[model samples]
Target: MSSSARPARRRLQRAALPISAVMLLSLASAGCGASVGGAPPCLPPEHTVSPSSAKPGDSVTVSAPDAKCDPRYGEDAVISIVFIDAAGVEVLNTTAPMADAGGFNFTAEVPLNSAPGVMAVNAMPHGVDWCDDTGKNNRVSQGELPLERASCVLPTKPLNITK
Candidate 1:
């Protein structure tokens, strides 16, 4: 092969990457409720945690107003919210089925065993544990979803668990 052809081949290979990625994204967004072609279509909801603070064991209302979903996900598709305490442990996982407007609202309890501090909560597709053992200490359980950015974490204000 000519040197010029080598460069062209390299360019073609590079070009194929984005094409492959797009194809993969398309198939993944098709949402069979699982990852396909190295992409996971986990569209996080536009949600709010009412009160922004709660006592341990207390419940707060979580609502998502314009929850977006790709064409693959049906109107009745489900979204799961994961609550991780300061210790990087998942306290609760709530699966909420979307409504006609593609949104969900529910009440979740802050772990009564959780210490008084900030907690992180995020929503993603059901079955994909996007935010599990958060501190990256490698204690995470199975089914952790790997995403290429675009994390769908909610809660504008820090959810402080009161003492």
Candidate 2:
């Protein structure tokens, strides 16, 4: 409580305040780094495609699990459909960005004019190397589904079209 000692006490308190704040900030930022302390490991998103095989003009639905984990890398998973010919040539390729929901569902009409031949349908985590081969790639989860053949003729029954 002496006047001479008061300045020393104030200086010590000020120094301690900055040190304490820095410690707290360091701890807080440490948690923000990739794979935070004791946090659940983030696995890549999983995907599935309903009716893995389909004909031209058929509706194909692709579903993917949410990609937003504790450490979110990005939003909007991209879903794509690639049509290939019998000789293993890519005919048409289409890609669409879908929001990351608990599961993302995408329905697209396979182009009626798409070349008729064996094709592959793949649903994978956007921007990831889902499969080993490019053209043979299937759903990352499904490993590799056999190549699907699109018939030149439409279905026998009258096809019902609905959005």
Candidate 3:
């Protein structure tokens, strides 16, 4: 090759090294569960419903401890308990703010006219600002969290509500 062409080729080769390094670094960091593009490797929270079997119009207490909610939402986080009938229709929906300890104790009353079959009671954290919106609490689900951001729904378990 010509001398000019040889120098140009060497310059291109030198520039490619830094570009490739940056690309590789980005890809490596993306899979470490540090970003909020998807669900993190957080452990699913445990759900407990008092009086697991209850009649219609009964009061039930659904509690979650060691919840992985962001500290920013420690008191403002919205915790919900939803009951769906066997036919997959919502029978009862109850929501309350997180307790001082970053957990939930939602007391819900079953619908009086609810059907008499097994109902699914799910307790989860809704609308939690994973703190990444503006960098205040930008981390998503890590150890015991369910989602990566407030835009996503947290994990839940089924509680059998009997009639």
Best by TM-score: 1
Residue-pair clashes per candidate: 0, 0, 4
What would the TM-scores of all predictions be? 0.52, 0.40, 0.52
- Per-residue lDDT tens digits for candidate 3, residues 42-110, read 332456678767887788887777536323344566766677765567777778776543467778677
- List runs of model 2 lying over 4 Å from the truth: 1-41, 67-73, 100-103, 113-118, 125-163
Displacement of residue 155 (Cα, Å) in model 3 is 3.8
Q: List the lowest-lDDT window of 10 residues for candidate 3.
A: 26-35
lDDT of 2 by residue, 39-123 (tens): 6544334555566556777886766666566434347556554544333445556776755432457777766655454344434
Full ranking by TM-score: 1, 3, 2
Top lDDT hit? 1
Model 1 segments beyond 4 Å from truth? 1-45, 67-72, 127-157
Write candidate 1's Cα lDDT for 1-163 as tens digits: 7767777766765563332233234333322222224455434445667878889878887777653443244566677777766665668877887664446777877778876667666555564443332323234343332232232223332467788
Supply the global lDDT for candidate 3.
Answer: 0.55
Question: Which consecutive 10 residues in model 2 have the weakest lDDT in total?
Answer: 150-159
